[model samples]
Target: MRPAMLIRLALLALLVAFIVTPETFAPVFQPFTKNGAPAIYTQTSLLSLTLSHLAIVAVATVAATLFSVGLAIIVTRPFGVEFLPLSRSIANIGQTFPPVAVLALAVPMFGFGPIPTLIALFLYGLLPIFENALTGLTNLPGNVSEAARGVGMTGRQRLTQVEFPLALPVILAGVRLSVVISLATATIGSTVAAKTLGEVIIAGLLSNNTAFVLQGGLVVGVLALLIHDAFVMFERSIARRTGRLY
Candidate 1:
């Protein structure tokens, strides 16, 4: 294995040992009576929540990818040049919005469920995905774009056949960012009865049990790491196939 891959494996193994053997640290953070079943308090509930949150991340990512790439193409055109700043502003606003507050506000209309949570996650995820895609596609060599035109490629054809493929690595990198943030933020959904790992963390805070909170926090961190690494590997694979990145 490559040195970097070996190092990552060692670190991941350490994390697994720490999480799976939480009892080993009992002397430090002893077992408090948690709300869930004893087994649930370990990793079972945490894992389930993380997986649910991944579904939320997937939805938000796909939506953002379509929106961003479409807007990038439109605004890059001569007739659409006036709208680039507007597109950028929208993306910036999405990033700047408070996801928790967004979820809370959305509760009144959406009626206290995963919808608000999904919306918040969607907003939080959209910006980076949109911006990075915009940057990635727009930053390519002008000559390449010109060559596409010289070959009688229509706008859609050039975007699909050339631009999107070239920009996919940056897009995937944005997705990794969105997934990590979504995983960490999904815990906020628990307040609105959203099924996420955040329930444990929130409950831990309410009951003032540091161990409970630590377990949830630790799980979220590890899940984010795993998701990020997985996406990055997937991104590298795609980029290599297209010869867009190494």
Candidate 2:
């Protein structure tokens, strides 16, 4: 009903149409190509490339979330507090190291494919989620935590029932950032023979086909926007349920 929601739905529909029946829109891209060059990327189905691209990002983001959140939980515990700096350094490794370098290093051991890409993405996505989780877990209202303890809740029970739930919106915010970054970065995985939307962009670059480049970039940009919006909606929903939303 809202204009923003309507626009998002329209974008989603157009993205699906582009992926499922790209050739039908070739005429729209005709002006961007040479007089006789193909106006759309046809070597691989856009739908397949999109799906593969999402799969890689999803897998990497999930892996990063689990590791980062778990590490955050550990470091927040009394016994694990001393390890906080070490944990921060470990999470920072991904951001400090170049993704291309990670890919190059991983290729020999993992071989050219999604595996190397997954390694690069997984490492790259860690810092945001880790930092957010740490912030959320550490910044809880003192009274709420005291109340949980006053109710005779064990540390583990309080964490599982109260702390984690309250912190979820913040954690989700980090996950959203990680996912968006991974979506764009995963395109680089194509250099190592990974199946991704980057294939279209790379082919276009090699052939000097603006149409191909535009199609690839447009699809990736739209996907990132849609995913970002989806995360925002989910984060807001969680915040509302947790009484964190105004």
Candidate 3:
């Protein structure tokens, strides 16, 4: 009965419509199609494209999360503190170069398809997660660490038990940002022969099929919103459990 519940239901219904009966929504796109053209984007299944898009983003996000969080942890440690600036510079390099450029440069070595796209997405998604992980690890309350040390906890134990739990919410915030950004950016992968919603948009552009463009754009937009909302909910849950408020 809550607004949140209703919104979730609505999103679920919309996703089902897109997956199960995309044609049911085709009529709305009729104005975009040419006089003699089909009003629907029929070259590929929207569901399949959506799944592939999410899979690419998921893999890239996972890779970014591991590398960024690991680097952040390493640079924050006593042994590796000196490398903080270098790590930061490396992470920033990805953001400095646009994802499109990364793809362009990567394609030469990686060849066309998802590999180049994966590399671009992985590089592009690193900064926020890295920064957030660094902040979370470095900003722990002094007393907490002292208490952890006083309890005869080893450095590893303190890190795993006392520090990480408190830092998880902040880290999740970064991941949320990374994921949403990756979702939007993943569409560009189609330019390099990767299968994505962007393929539909590109086809529409080349053939002058407005319906295809609209359909692809709408699907991608809806997916981004859906995934973002899911992350928002997850971040909130983490914050609440961690005794933090976003």
Leading candidate by TM-score: 2
Model 1 weakest lDDT span, ten residues long: 36-45
Task: Summarize candidate 3's per-residue lDDT along 1-246 as a digit string, tens digits.
Answer: 989879877977887697667889877888888867887777888888888998999999999999999999899889999999999998897799999999989999989999998998899989999999999999888988899999899988988997888888889889889988888899899999998888888889989999888878887777777777888888788778877767
lDDT of 2: 0.96
RMSD of each: 3.7, 0.7, 1.3
Pick the winner on lDDT between candidates 2 and 3: 2
Question: In lDDT terms, which candidate is top?
Answer: 2
Candidate-wise lDDT, in order: 0.76, 0.96, 0.88
Name the regions of candidate 1 deviating beyond 4 angstroms. 3-44
Tens digit per residue, CA lDDT, model 1, 99-184: 87898689999897688888888778778887787788888778899999999999889988998888889888987898788888
When 1 and 3 are scored with TM-score, the better candidate is 3
Better structure of 1 and 2 per lDDT:
2
By lDDT, rank the candidates, best first. 2, 3, 1
TM-scores for all candidates: the values are: 0.83, 0.99, 0.96
* By TM-score: ranked, best first: 2, 3, 1
